[model samples]
Target: MNVPTVPMLFVEIEGVLRKTPDDLGRPWKGPFDIEVFPDAVERLRLWKGAGGRAIGFSQQGGVALGETDEQTAVRTLWTVRERVANLLDHVVHCPHHPEAAMPDHARCWCRLPKPGMLIAAQHEVSLRQQERYPLWMALLVARSPEALQAASDLGLDHLHGDAWRRDGGQ
Candidate 1:
């Protein structure tokens, strides 16, 4: 058996690259206002400058709950992607939730901790680049135990987001 050696970085968006709306007092809205952490961006800048690729793995469940919609969710992601140049190569967001108000947004295998998002991204990368999985690192926020568990389930190497940043994202 052979393993794929594409060396892609699978990263968590909220709480990792960008500071999320944990203190917003409401579900986040579209046209995302949060700034990507400076050090995080610096790390990614260096990472990409060295010819590495990164993909943001996120779940925009606000669409499911009626706080936002799918288009807005997608736009927000692309908006962020435009902000940071040459860091993230792609973005994958899941708008599903088991308790979604909209029927279509409810229940999916793509939410974090489920591996759907990662698997889909895997296929996407392999298809587009003709190369595949490497030892992906799920750079997760320290507060998210669920993401850590999900990374383990996906059989990828993992690291704490803050620590990774502090370590200069090596």
Candidate 2:
């Protein structure tokens, strides 16, 4: 039997890419100084070299906490995109949290442990590529339990730990 394949990958940002912000709300001031974890760049390269498509997913509730606004968050992500242009195909961010200081920002979808972002990305990717793959067939590379749980809920393949390095020293 012949089987079709989709070379897509979903990766988490916060802990996997950079150190989890000391305070998600006030991680940094002035600009987003993303300190990428060791082997993060390399991992993306290997995955791309193997012909895997990569999409970035991050749960950032900083904006809702009144630390920043949507515009700032987008700008930060834009900077990240510029740096990882060759590796990432696209990025999806969640700026909502249940405990948001801003009432308007509270209680919304797109948070991890919830499949909103993944489902949205899947739909967007399917539309853009003009092809659909079962959610379980997609691969998730990350080190966040929330992202991993979200992957599990969606039945996607998930990998986590030490920037995906063999040694747990990331």
**lDDT, candidate 2, 1-170, per-residue tens:** 44345677887776666555672444555345765655776777877788666778877798888877888887766666565654877778999988986766887778888888877876786667665566656678777788888888877777784637444233
Question: In model 1, where do residues sit more than 4 Å from their true spots?
Answer: 1-4, 22-29, 101-104, 136-143
| TM-score, candidate number 1 | 0.82
- Candidate 1 lDDT, 2-58, residue by residue in tens: 544546677777777766777355555557575667777877787667656678877
The alpha-carbon RMSD values of the candidates against the true structure, listed in the order shown, are 3.4, 4.0
Sliding window of 10 residues with minimal summed lDDT for model 2: 161-170
lDDT of prediction 2: 0.72
> Which pairs clash inside model 2?
none
Q: Best by TM-score, which number?
A: 1
Error of 1 at 168 (Å): 3.7
